[model samples]
Every structure is written in structure tokens, then in C-alpha cells.
Target: MKISLKKTDLFVGIYLLSAVMFFIISIPSWLLDFLLAFNLSVALIVLFNALFAKEVLDMASYPTILLFTTIFRIGLNVSSTKLILRDGDAGKVVLTFGQFVGGGNLVIGIIIFIIIIIIQFIVINKGSERVAEVTARFTLDAMAGKQMAIDSDLNTGAITDKEAAEKRKKLQQENAFFGSMDGATKYVKGDATAGLIITGINLVGGIVMGMLYSGLTVNEALNKYTILTIGDGLSSQIPSLLISLATGILVTKASSDGELGDEIVGQLFSIDKVLMMVGAALVVMGLFTPLPNYIYIPLGIALIVVGRRLKKRTGVEAIEEEVEESEAEAQEIRKPENVVNLLNVDPIELEFGYGIIPLADVNQGGDLLDRVVMIRRQVALELGAVVPIIRLRDNIQLNPNQYIIKIKGIQVSDGEILFDHYMAMNPGYVEEEITGIPTFEPSFHLPAIWITESQRERAESLGYTVVDPPSIIATHLTEIIRQHISELLTRQDVSNLINNIKDNNQALIDELVPKLLGIGEIQKVLQNLLSEGISIRDLVTIFETLADHASVTRDTDILTEYVRQSLKRAISGKYFPSNETTSVVTLDPNIEQEIMSSVKNTEQGSYLSLDPERTKKIMASTGSELKKLEDMGKNPIVITSPIVRLYFKKLAVDYYKDIIVISYNEVESNVELQSVGMVTA
Candidate 1:
């Protein structure tokens, strides 16, 4: 491949090289004159570019520019000092400043040069250094918070992953720019100081050389050398000072909008009242004080006229804006409704009323958005499922304290919260209660009380589980997501999971997905596992199991059983407490036999086709046995034979959805289970 450079690149390349050459090789006065002019032009370009750039990132390479300009400026200073001592004339540019700007006065030119140094070094350069240092520190410190905000926006579907990536890139550029600027200010300060030193050296060298070689008297040599030195200093410092000013402006600029001029004008002078008052003050000063009335009086009167006219125009603009808004509203009402927008639905939505708004508003110290992000992460860890973006919105139709959680546009559950209070629930052991508004916990419908901040400490002391409003909403949202995570796992989500697996285990994914089972089939199997509160995180095992058994059976229910049995260790760890005996109920042989006999295997799938009356008896007996386990402070786990486990779970789902049915094949042998009771019909 061949490479080519643009004209701008070549120009910049040559210019920087010339700056270095100027420091080594003596050039003719004309060439020096042209280079000095070129330097001034470049400085002006940089100053304007820094001034008008809408964002600092627009000038992301500014620090490098600063280094280049400083090197070039120092080269000019050195070359001119040599010319002043040897030939007594640097160039026409330096001479023009000496004669014209100083009005033929050596003292005036020297004083002016010193003043420039003071302003640039003590004021502009110093302020820029401080501003850049602080900006860099603050920018770096804020990066973590900005990154999390981007992630939360991405998870909430407020921004796409691509947009988030762009934002992160911009943030990194800003950090780099500010960090480099913090150091770049040093170069400007050093350049100004070096110029001052060079000017002084030139003054001394020129006077001594002129007196000895040119046959000039002491005063003549002093006047001649001092004028040229001041001229050279002025020519160099002017451009250097402009650069310093640009640096200060760029660092202090916070707007990513228009130029500095526009922001200053619009912010300070746009207000009619401020303009009018200033006009009044100027007019009063002109009349009452000894200041020149001719200068102040006309300016004040013109300002007063401008302010009154601006006020009238502003009023007209406001009326025009109202007219435009009314016209827009009328046109909107006349237009046909947008059916496309109405057809789309967010995957998850948490709409609350006005009073509950603060609980979701991040600016008001609410962390509901952060909690929502954590809920997504928690679901991924717990069930190996990606919860869809949860949307937060406010609805005026709801009662002030009410909020509803919707899945696919339909409200599944709702809860009311007193915004300024905490919900305290007894954890079954606390006999003491604090006084508060009585309520029920929305997630579990357990009895709770809404207590004020004053009572929160007392309630916690009494052993009540106290939760704030945001936590309450987050908890309820999490529970709802977990309960419906199975249905939420679409084919796209399954494909995403497969893609994630392909990153490391391509062979397993390639062989298992679409070869033995389609995405829908895989989805159904995963859903089946999720529906039973089993995690599918170990997709390698799940996919490997499917690859082994899917060729024999495509039925999701039967495949699910194979998966569950394959994941017995995980299942055992989940349901059976660690290193402890678990008291559970076992299904009677008659009931297991009946469940298996009633299972109907069709081309679609397998399900229990038990008689309705017999089903009622089975469900009643199952619930009663599970209730006994519950009363014994144990989870409602049922142990059944391998073949009847799936069918028995199906039979019990109509009445006892919370029942945890496991097969003898699905429990690890190390797990100890005590059969406290048996379910018989």
C-alpha cells in the first residue's frame, strides 16, 4: 500500500522544520521578516480557533500545538537577538515596531515590553495554569460517575450501545485534553520568561559591540541598542501574549455552544433591565460628576434608546412565540394520530405518579436508576437471563402516591408509597411495634407500616425490616422481573446467549444450536429451567446436555428434565441448605403412579391429562403436605420418582405454583433429605 499526505500536513511539516532550522542557520533579513510575519499569522489562527471552538475536544490536539508554537517562538527570539548584536537590524517587522509603536522613544518601548511580560506571566499564564490544573483534576474525578451514567442510560434504553460508546470516547478525549493542557501551560510561561531574558542579553551585547566596533559613543549605542531590543521584544511578546490569552479563554470556557463573544453578549447584555439600569447610571454620572459629558452623555443616550427598542422587540418576539405555539397545537390537533408510535411498547415500564416522582428522579437524590441497573445485573447473575430495559415515566392519571409496573404495555402489579416515609415490616420475631401508618409490603403483600424518619430508628431497634421508598420500588420491580423472566426470554435473547457462548466455546454452540435444536427450542428449554427457579448461567453444561440428548428427543419438557438432572449439583446447592438436613415432603407411590399414567405425550409436547376430580384431590393433598413443611420452617420441597417428577409438578402447578418438585435423579447424593410427611390422595 502507498501513503500520501494532504497539503495541510505538508505545510505543517515544513513550517515546524523551518522553525528548528532558524535556530541553527543565519538567514537574510527579508527571510527573517517573512518568517516573523508568518509566525504572527499562525498565532492569530490559533487564538481564533481556540476562541470559537464549541467544545474543547474540537481542539483535542491543542497541547501539541502549544508545544510547537513555543518552540517556533523561541527560535524567532534567538535569531532576532543574534541579528541585533551582529548587524544591528533583525528585520523590517522589528524595526517598524521600534519606530512606530514606540513613537521613537526607547524608554516607552522598553516599558511597554516589560508590561507585556508582567501581564502574560503574572496574569494570563498564571491563571491558565491554575484553571487547567483544576479542570484536569475535576475531569478525572468525574469520569467514574459519567461512565456509570452512560451505562445506566444504555441499560434503560435511553441510549443505544453505539451512542454510549461515542459518549465514552468524547469523555476520554476531554480527559486527555485537560490533562495535557495542565502541563502545556508551563511551556507558555517558560517561553515568555525566556523572551524577557533574551531581550536583556541583547541589550547588553548590542551596547558593548556597538561602542567597540561601530565607533559609536556610549549614549548613542545605548539608545540604538535599547530601541532595537525593545522592538524585538514587542514583536515577539505580542504574539506570545495572544497565545496566552487564548489559553486562558479556552480553559475558562464552559459552553459547547457559540463563540465566547456570543455567550458573553447573550448572557450579560441580553437582559433589557440590566442594560436600562447601566444606561441610567452612565447618564447620571455624566450629568452629576466632573467626567466628560460629551463622551458619556451620547453613549448613555444611545444605550437607553437601544434598551427600550430591544425591550419592545423582545415583547413582540414573545407574542410571536405564543402565536407559533398556538398554531402548532392547532395543527397537531388537526393531524391524524400516529399509529406507529402507539403500536410500539417498552419491554418494561415503571410509571409512577407525581408524589412518587422524587423516588425515581436521580437529580433529587433518588437512586432508583442505579438500583434498576443493579436489578438487571442481579437477574443476569441469578437466572442467567437479561432483563429488558426498564423505563421510568410519570403518569398524571394515577393517584399521587401510586405506581405501577408494566411488562409489554400491560400493568401486572402496582403499589402505593408514602414518599417521605419508610416501610417497616416485622420479620416474624419482633413483638414490639412502632407507631406509624399501617400498610402492606407490595412485593410480598406482607403487613407493614409506613413510619416517619423520626420513627425509623425506633422501628429498626424493634427489629423491623425498614425500607425507603426507592428500595421498595426496586424490590418490587426485581421480584416482578424474576417471576416473569421466563416469558421475557425471547428468541433474540436466546441468540444473544448463544453468541455470548460462542466467544469462548464456539464448537459447543455450533454443534448444539440449530444443528440439534433451533433457537426456539433452546429458548423453550431455557424458559422451562427459568420457570422452575433454576439458573441457566452454566450454558456450557446446558448446551452440552442438549447436544447429547436433543437428537433423541425434541420435546422441551423432556429436554428440560434432562437439563435439570444434568445440573443436579447446582440444583442441590440451590434447594438444599449447605451441610444441613432439609425436611421435605415425599410423594406417595400411588400419587406418583397416577401422575405418570395421566401424562399425555403428543407431537406438541408432554402435559398431565389427569381427571379434573382426581386432579383436585392430588392438588389438595400436595398443598396440605407443603403447608406442613412451611409450618416446620422449611421450604415446600417435594421429592418424587424420576419419571413422575415433571408430571407431578405440572399437576400441582394449577393450585400450588410455589411447590418445588424435584426428582430422585436431580438431587446430589451428598444432600441429606428427611421426609417429614407424604402427599397421598
Candidate 2:
């Protein structure tokens, strides 16, 4: 049988093997030298990797690497201590370090080793551990908000599903990596403590062994054993210091597009004025103080030269590069495929002319974008549907004060507003007229005037409803969206809605979706409800109703009527108070009979086929009654028999768009109804 191991497996095997070898009684001097060298090389590699990594996830395994290297260093400390206790010399590496680096002074070597430990354990390691903890906490706290943003982007078509998934995965990995680092920092702290304890043991144990067992004198034993113990401590502590520094760099470094070294250099020297000021200050100090001219003058002059060169390069070269990049982007935009991308349309778009730009700019105190996001949230709560992002842009072809609202590339409404003026509407009881440019409110087409800022208080004193430019636009956009919501509900949106509730209602969804009724069929039912201004927020009830009657009727209009009857309370509460009587217009019995008689049923659906003359009479009567109800300050609702409700709605929709048509079945038992007017034919 052949045995094959992957790279990761082989690396793990080598690590375990090395861990076991640290327990051996004796290690050769040459092997001890090799281990010390390997420790230093690993520390250097870790530092470079941390400094150059483009993203945190790119160094996902850094915590593991840190743990393994720390263990290896501690093992080396143990093995070298054993060697020193057995003999005066630990190895060539330790001996050279003690004699050359410390000048063969035991006190100097011991002091140097103590300083290294203090810096690593008290300063670098402590700070890195704190940073790791804070970073991990912040990453976890922001994870939910970031995930929601990704979902919003995907729903708005700003990003694809795959891209959203990748971003979510990267975010999760980053959280995990930082969390691991939080725990791994403790390893470094412990390793430092262990090193200190081991060095103390080596010094005491080496002294006792030399005097009592080898028969050396007190002074002689002190000199020989102390030197060897200091050497062993310095050899292990130096690499420990390097590894600790690397951990500090990894945790404290900010994210950047380039390497850490390049970022440090570029940012530090980017401002030429600062460098010039520093150079001038240095030159002044050199002249006023006893500093050598040979050292300070040349350094100052070199700084001044470099500052001038950087200033010229950044100013001229940066502009040229920007111009080139813009030209390249323009060329790419002119390509056929890029132009074709413009053919894709937003579900809702708001376009304005150049004069209204300040209304959308946040720096100018405009809150249009903020208002738009709030509008989306409000609509979702009210309508029980996710509103796609509305794309806003400027169109130079339009008049400076003109704005247009579009749905799916077709303009639905257009108006002009004075950006610098306020709209003051006479609330049907204003005692005085305000002197200004005469206009009408864009949303409701109510008569209004655009008054100056000085007239705002005067208009309000006269009971006029005054609004700013943003409020006017926001109100108009809201009304437009409310009117066209039916067109916005797609199969994908229905799927999202179902998926959102799947965790709690999995069985209901499994029974109703793609089995009893397809998603497209369900979408049509929802659109029907939305078209009639009925909120489907109670989706559980809606799905249950469909599951009960979907097999009986395949017609969406009929199914929508069933859903409406099931949501009677929600519908009633929308137009009237729960305890108040619902005031509505009642169709004459003769007209109801005529409409019910003209209803034709086919494989397609049920519809009315009344004669032209009769249709005109019915529309004329309904319009007159609806106007009366509107004048009385009562919202107009038409009530008829359940069998003729759908047919009557079809007849009046084109002419009486504002009137809500409901059947007797849609009225709940808890509410009372009063006939405010009669639509007679």
C-alpha cells in the first residue's frame, strides 16, 4: 500500500514530531544552533506576512502559526537550559551571543536579557492583546448591519447573488480570524512568563551543579555558570522579542491597499510643506545649538531637495494620471456592450435638472437620500413588500427647475419646483391669500403658491400648509410609489417574502407554494391586493386562505377576493376607525343587477361586457356619488354584492381611480356600515 500525505498533513506531522523531540534528555550543540536559526527565520517570515497581507482573511492561519512558533521557542529554551546545567557551555550560538554581544560581562548580559523580557511582556505583548480583543468585539458587533447591507445591495441589483455570498463569507472569516487572535495573544504572554522562570532556574541550578558536584570554587562557579545561564536566556529571549513584535504589528496595523512599508513612507512624505518646515527647523536648531554642521546641514539640505521633488511629482504627475484614467473610462463607456447596459431599467427612478442638485447634496444640508431610505422602510412596514432602490440622477436635457418620475423607463409624472422658495397651500379655510408665484401641489394637484422665505411665517399664520422643496418631492414620490406598487411585485420578490418566513412556517410554505399554487400565481394574487390598496402584511393568514381555497379556484381575481374577505379587519381599519361606522356609497339595486347580468365567465377570467351606453350611465352615476363623498371629507368606498364586486371594480377602475370597491363579504361583523350616498343608473 502507498501512503500519500497532503501539504497541510505533512506540516502538522512535522510540528507534532518537533514537539515530541523537545522532551529528549540531551540535544546536540549543532542541532541546538539549527533550532535557534530556524526560530529567527520563522519570526522574520511572520513579520513580513503580516505587513504585506492585503486583507485579514488572506492571513487566516496566522493565529495557528503564532501558536506553533511560540511553542517551538519555548522548547528551545528548555533544551538549552538542560544543556547549560549539564555543561558550562550550552552551544556555539549561546556562547557567541554571551561573549560577543555582551562583551563577556555576566552583569551586562543579564541586564540586557531582563530588558528584552520587560519590553516584550509589559509593552508589546500587552498592547497587542488589548488591540486584538477590541478588534474582535467590533467586528462581531458590526456583522449584522453589514450582512443587511449586502442583502439590500443584492435586492437593488447593485450586486449579484454570488458577490453577496462571497462578501458574507469573507466577513464571517474575518470575524473568526480576529477572535482567534484574541486568544492567541495570551499564548505570547504566557511564553514570556515561562522564559523568565526558566532563566532563573538555569542560573540557580547551574551554580549549584558546578560547585557541589564538579567541585569548583564559589567565584569560579559564579563566573562560569552565570555566563552560560545569561547566554541561554539571551538566545531564547531575542527570538521571543521578535515574535512578540510581529504579533503587535499584525494586530495594530490598519487595512491598506499597499504594503505597510509603502503606506508608511507614502503617507509620511506625501505633504511637502511639513517636510520643508521640519528641515528649516532642523537647520535653525543646528545653528543655534552646538550640533555639528557636518551632520545637520547636509541632512536638512537633502530633506529640502526631496520635499521639492515630491511636490513637483505629486502635483503635475498626479493630474496627468487622473486625466488619462478619465479618458480610458470614457472610452470604455462608449463601447457597445457598455452602452447596452443602459437598456436595463430601474423599477422606480427620480430624475431632476441641474438647478435642484443642492436638494440632494448632503453637504448643503439636503436630506433627500436619508428621506428616501426612510421612505423604503416605511413602505415595507405599510405594504408588506420590499421596495427596490429608487435610482436618482440628474438630466441636463430637462428644464433647470423641472423634475420627472419614471416607472420602468416610462415617465409617469413631471413637475417643476422652485428650489429656493417654499410651497404654501391654502387649506380651504385660509383667511388671506399669499402673494407669490401661483402653482399647484405636485402630489395632489391642489392649488398652491411658491412664496419667498420671508412669507413663510405669514402664510402659516393664515392657516396655509407650507412645505420645503425636499418635503414636496418626498410627498410626490411617496404618492407615485403607492399608486404603482402593483407593478413592482415580481416572482423574485414573492420568493424573498416566502423565504423570509420559511423558518417559522415551513410546512405552510411547503404545502401552498409550487404544489397548490405556483409562485407566479401567488405573485398575481399579491399584485391584485396591492392594486386595490390592500396590505398583505398578514401573509400567514393570506397563505392559509390560499391553501384552503387555491385548489377550488384557479383565478387570481377570485382568489384575491377570498384573501380580501379573510383580511377584512385589516382593510376596515385602514379606511375607518374600528368603532366608527364605515360610510360608503351603495350601488342601486337596478344597476347591480345590470352589472351582474353582463358578467361573462370564460377560461381566461370573469369580466363585464356591458353596452357602451349603459357603461357610460354607470360611470356617470358612480363618479357623481364619489365626488359627493369626497366633498363631505369621507373616503369613498363602494359596496355591492359579492358576486358583482369584481365586475363592478373593473367597470369603475378606469374612470373612478380613487374609489375603493369592496363586497358585503369583505365587511367584518364587528363594524357597522352606513350608506352615505347611492349610485343610481
Candidate 3:
């Protein structure tokens, strides 16, 4: 179970509520007074500590602060009592000070709260050095999921698996070493500023609590300590100064973050030694017959300076150690070349297609504007033609007179041939010419003449086999027409063409493949096309239509049946049928018998045939849809029967042509046009 921030906040709320209710309700009246004062001062401090400690020492920070505060407060209480019991003069001064500062107990409790707050702040406010480490860790954790997501998407056919895997692998490998570097960097940028701010806030709160408690109680307890002098007030605050100085130094030392077991100069000096020095000095001053009130100021300032210097020195050394460690770890991650290679290349494939186009110099109104330019340089080796594929820039429109032609993708020589030479021979179209010259029987023709030889030769070699009348102007027109159609039959165009074909002759789809492959140069271009994400089946459909236009096929019953079956598969969205069974439920004998009984009961020796039942269903769906158009004041033909679907498919080509024109006009005018208007137009 992943822990969320919301959960953490909820836990904190629960902890706070439990603490407030239990501690406040259970204590005796007198004890409760003391506990209330203590809890009030410490509540915010403890909460801050809880929040900060999570970052400081993996849960240890919180418990450590709690333990230290308890011990220190108790020790302060003991010392205050000893002074009051042993020396009348000191006792008088101490009592007066304690009462004025909200009593000895309140003062001590407040100080402890301040100390914990400061410690937590220091821990939480760690600097930028750690940010990189955190980012790196986050990156590493995210990589595996990202890679898996890519794999799942690809395997499920949402995208190509190879592409997804490769992209993810690249990112993961690049950032593998980043995490280590980040960890070391963050360790050196300890929480000094954060610790200081926390300490400052706690110090202010402690001061306010101490002042309120002491000021209020001091007058009441004043007569108890007759020996109390003006100087006692100043002298009494020495411990607070000493504690703050000691804490600041301690926080700085903690920030150093050296080796877990490394011996430091501060470690040698020891917390015990530091405490003993302060304790002995205080005791000696107290034992004196006449203690100077200003004695603590110098001592407090000295201790602060000493602590600050110590922290500064140790911190620098710790940072150096961290930097060296990072460099060393980075070195270890450098595996032998082969091991590195394993994680280097992603499992993704980026099929190289046409090169980038130069659009800056293109003129929107020029003849070249409507022409598609394909960069054949990369896949040029597979095609016989110079241009491998076509891509038209913006500001170009398809010619209304042009019809798209596509050749089935077949591997061909030089990657430029219109169709595969080997497949072209399959339909008995290849033969010796009548003029005793070895030439293609279906010679390339065009409706225009005076066009450059480059265009004519390109069209012929690519299998355009332009067949134009002998008139020069006719040849030029034919060439121009073929070129315009070629430009329009780009990858996008071919896809739309296949969709239209599939809508009509789905049964003959398999046979359509060979015929489409018979179109010139399309087969040669298929390899380059795979990268563009054109499906093999759709590509075959486009080629088939082009082949059909070039060589009209006679209507045959066998071909018609094939077309129908293909259409059914398409309508049902069954692209690839498989023999493998994926469902795991086993058939029960009793259920099987029951199913057979049901079937036998329903069986009336009636065979399923094309009839009114099926036709009625189609009509209900289609006619209802057509009625919707009519309600909207649109004139749409209602063709429900399969026979009518066939007739419309052949004859309704002009209907779609008109629809496209109306759509174009609406777009040009930037006005919303109703489908009814479009249909009527």
C-alpha cells in the first residue's frame, strides 16, 4: 500500500486529538494546571518536530527530540530545586525569577519545546543539494512503470510495441547514474537555515512564556527570597543563552553528514565535556559569596562563538567527503562496455522514411504547390524512381478531375518500380511487342505532350504505362492528369480510398491484393510506407482499385462471393481471425445437453437464407437513420436491401462527390451548413 500525503495528515490529526484529550482530562487539578501550561507551550513545537523529523532521521528524529526534551526539562527542574533548598539568597532570587517567568516548571517546559522545534526546522530545511537526489530517485522509480506501460500498449495493438519500448529504454538508461550523484549532493547541503528558523520561532515562544509566567509569579514569590538582587534577573537567563548556542553548534555539526562512523573533532570534544564545562562554571559562580550578574553574558557569547566555529569546520569537511563519495560511486556504475550495451539500445524501432521537406521557398500559388514531393534518398535503393513517396504541403487541393491510383506494396528492384516486376508477370500482361522490338505491351501513355522527358520516363519506369492517343496535345494532357492523380494518391489518400472500397466490395478483398500489387511502383514503395503506419490490408485494397482501373475485371460469381465474405469480415471488425482459443471456461456436460435441447426445440428444419427478416432489420436501422435526415429537411436516399447497397455503391459515387463539394464550399465560407443542405445541393 502506497502512503499518501492525505494519510499522513490524517494520522497527525489523530495523534494530536488523542494527546489533547488524554493528557488534559486525566491529570489532577493541581497537576492539570502544570500540564495545561506545559502542553500549551509544547503543542505547536511537537507538531513542527513531528513534521520535520520525518525528513531528518527516518522516524528516529521525532523520538529523539521527545526523549531529549523530557530529560533536559527534568534536569532543569532538579537544578532549580537544589538552588532553592541550599542557598537562601539564591533560593529567593530563583523563586522570584521562576514565579515571574511562569514558574520553574513552565520555564523548563517552554525551553524544551523551543529546542525540539529548532531541531526539526533545521532537519526539514535541507538545501538544494538534496533536490537532485530526490528527483533522481523519483525518475528511477517511474522508469519501470513507464516501460511496462509502453509494452502493454504496443502488445495490445494500441501502438507498435517496438516504438514504445525503445523510447522508454532510452530515458531510463540516460538517467541511471543521476540518482547516485543526487544522493551525495543533498547530504552535504544540511538543514542549517531551516534549523535556525525553527530555533528562532521556538526561542520567541519560549521567551514569551517565560516572561509571562515569571512576571506574574515573581511578585507573589518575591518575599520568599529576601536576598534576591537586581542582578539575579540578568543572571537567571544565562542557561537559555547557553542552550541556544549549544543547539546551534549541534545542528551545524549534524548538518556535516560525514561517514556514519567517522570520528570528528567535535566528537572528540564530546557532548559530555561541553555540558560539564557549562555546569561546573555555573556551579562555581553560584557557590561564590558575591556572584557578578554580568558573568553569564560573556560566557554565553563565548559558547555561541565556539559552537559556531566548530560547526563551520566540521561542515566543510563533511561536504568534501560527500563530494568524493559521489565521484567514486559514479565510477563504479561504469560497467564494462558490453554490460553497458545491454541497457543502451531500447527495443523501439523508428523506421526511416522520407527526409525533411524545405517549405520556406515553396509558393502556395505555384504549380509545385499542388505537387507532392517525396524524398527518395534513404529508401531510394529499393525504388527504381527517384522519389520514394509523396507529401503535399499546405495550400494545395486535390484536382476534381483526378482519380487516385495505388499499387500493392511488393518488394521491387531499386525500390522505385511502380509494382513488383515478378508480380506484374502473374496476370499475363507481359509480352513481346508487335513491332519486333522488346517492349512492354502496355506502353506508358499520357494525354499531353511537350512535357519534360524526366516526367515521362519516371512515369513509365514506375509502371504508369501511360496509354495516350498519338496527338501531342493529348499526350501532354494525359501526362498532366496522371501527375496530378499521383500527387493526390499519398498515404492519407490511399487510406481513405481503401475505406471506401471496403465499404463496397469486402468479399473480393483477398483477390484485390494481387490485382492492387499489379499497379506500377506501389509494391516497391511498401517498405518505406511501414514507418508511416499504413496497414498491409488497406495498402492492398488501394493497389487493387488502381489495378482494376487499369485492367477491368469481368464480374464473376466466385469473385462476387469472395467480395461479400470480405465485406462481412470488415463490417464485423474481424481483421485477423485466429485458431487459438483464449477463453478458459470448460463446457459442463449438463449445460451442453441443455443447450442442445434448446437448439433442437428451436430447430424447425429451417435454413438461414437471405430473406425479409434480415432485410427488414437492415432497413429498420438504415431507414430510421435516413428518416432522421429527412426530419432535418434533408433529401437522402434510403437504400436498405443488399441489392440496393450494391447499386448505390456503383452509382452513388457521384453523390459522395457532390457531398465533398458542398463541404468544401461551407469550409471556405466559414459558415455552418446543415447536412440537409449539403444532401440537397
Q: Decide which is better by TM-score, 1 or 2.
A: 1
Candidate 2 TM-score, true structure as reference: 0.82
Which regions of candidate 3 are displaced past 4 Å? 1-17, 22-350, 353-641, 644-681
Residues 1-681, candidate 2: write the lDDT tens digits: 999989989988887678568867578888989888888787888877877876666678989988888888888887898788886667888888877767878778878888888999999999999999999999899998687666645544578768988999988998898999999999999989998999889888988999988899888888888787777877878877888888888887777678888888888998998888888878887788899977887788778888899899889988999999999999888866756778888899889999988887656876676677667888889998778778778899999988999999999998899988999998788776879999989999999999999999988988999999998998999889989999998899999999988999999999998899999999999999998888878999999999999999989989998999999888878876787877799989899898888888999998788999989988898988888888888887999988778888888888877878888888777878889789887
Per-residue alpha-carbon lDDT of model 3 for 124-149, expressed as tens digits?
Answer: 32433344456567767887656655
* Clashes by residue pair, model 1: none
The predictions' CA RMSDs to the true structure, in order, are: 3.1, 4.7, 23.9
lDDT ranking, best first = 1, 2, 3
User: What TM-score fits each model?
Assistant: 0.90, 0.82, 0.21
Model 1: per-residue lDDT, tens digit, 131-236?
9999999999999899889877876578987898999999999998999999999999999889988988999999999999998899999998888888898889
Candidate 2 residue pairs in backbone clash: none
lDDT, candidate 1, residue 648?
A: 81
